[model samples]
Target: MLSSWFRVIRVKFLLASVIAVCLGLAINWWQNQTIDLVYAGLTFVGVIALHASVDLLNDYWDFKRGIDTKTKRTKFSGGTGVLPEGLLQPNEVYRAGLIFLIIGSSVGGYFIFEKGITIAVILAFAIISIYFYSTKIVNSGLGEIFVAIKGSMIVLGTFFVQTSHITMEPIFGGIVVGVLSSLVLFVNSFPDFDADKAGGRKTLVIMLGKKKASNAVWIFPIIVYGIIVSGIVLHVLPILSLITLFT
Candidate 1:
């Protein structure tokens, strides 16, 4: 039962949001040389809760739409098989998703109280987009874009909460993280192309067709490298960041 809950939350994929928050904090430390431990911890809890909410909700919606039923589940692409296997009831998953969403939003509310309108706006965007991501946004063929923006904002929001200001460092760092996240979603979409299309979901892979989408895979890495190189050249990011290129 515990393991089923973990699978429903997609614990491993939560790492993307973790990295995003860490990137923001790292950039804040680089620029300000300080961090508020309390705020940082709250930020992590909030982001992770929100991430879990989205994943749980995604599984619920996918199951509802019969997307999961049609797909060949794999480690990387298909939705978690928890629902199909009846490991958990649909209502239980839906409630868990909402509970996590509320927890995340409560944390954001605290930050907004401390930080002001900026945090409020970012939190608002996150809540709305997260709720609709598995439905409206993905169906519109904007899933990748939404993910990239979500990653970038997580970085921006974390930096803002810590430093009380914005800068080019977090912006560049956010873009890199955002693009990397979108790349994951873009690649994962391929195996789900048929399932997604049948469910009336329009992903980039479906929009482009597999062959063109295959060729387009190079774009994500290129954008990431381009930003890193540009940031270094412009003196916006530290030279040590170059080590990321090796990855």
Candidate 2:
């Protein structure tokens, strides 16, 4: 039962949020040399909750729309096979998604109270976009954009919560993490191109066609490396950050 829930939550993918938060913390520590461990831990829990919400909600909707039924399942692309296998009920998943969303939002609410309107705005955007991501955002072809922005905000929000201010360091770091996050979605879309199209979803893969999309894959790495190199050149990111390129 626990494993089934974990599968639906896509626990492995939650690592993206972890990386985003860590990037924000790393940037803050680089600049300020201090961190609020309590806030940091809370941020991780909140972000993970929201990430789980989005994945769970995505699975629910995909199954509901018959999209999951059409796509050939893969480790990366297709929806979790939980529903199709009757391991869980649709309403149960939907409720769990809402619960996670509320848990995440509660954490965000606490931050907003502590950090002011900045956290408020970020929380609002996250809640609204996350709830509608599969039903509307994906259908409108803005899924990739939303994902990029979400990742960026996680970094930015984490930094703001700790430092009570914004900086180019977090901004640039956020973009690198955000773009890399979107790349995951972009690549996954490739395998689901046919089902996504049939289900009235318009992903980057569908918009560009598989052939063009394949060629376009190079753009993601380029953006990530460009930002990293530029940040190092500008001295915004530490020289040690260059080690990321080796990965």
Which one wins on TM-score?
A: 1
The top-ranked prediction according to lDDT is 1
TM-score for each candidate, following the candidate numbering? 0.98, 0.97
lDDT score at residue 135, model 1, on the 0-100 scale = 93
- Window of ten residues with lowest summed lDDT in model 2: 236-245
Clashing pairs in 2: none
Identify the runs in model 1 with alpha carbons over 4 angstroms from their true place: none
lDDT of candidate 1 over 87-126, digit per residue (tens): 9999999999999999999999999999999999999999
Residues 1-247, candidate 2: write the lDDT tens digits.
8899999999889999999999899888888899999999999999999999999999999999989999999988799899989999999999999999999999999999999999999999999999999999998889988999999999999999999999999999999889999999999998898898999898888988999999999999999999999999998878888898898
lDDT of 1 at 28: 86
Listed per model in order, the count of residue pairs whose N, CA or C atoms clash below 3 Å is 0, 0
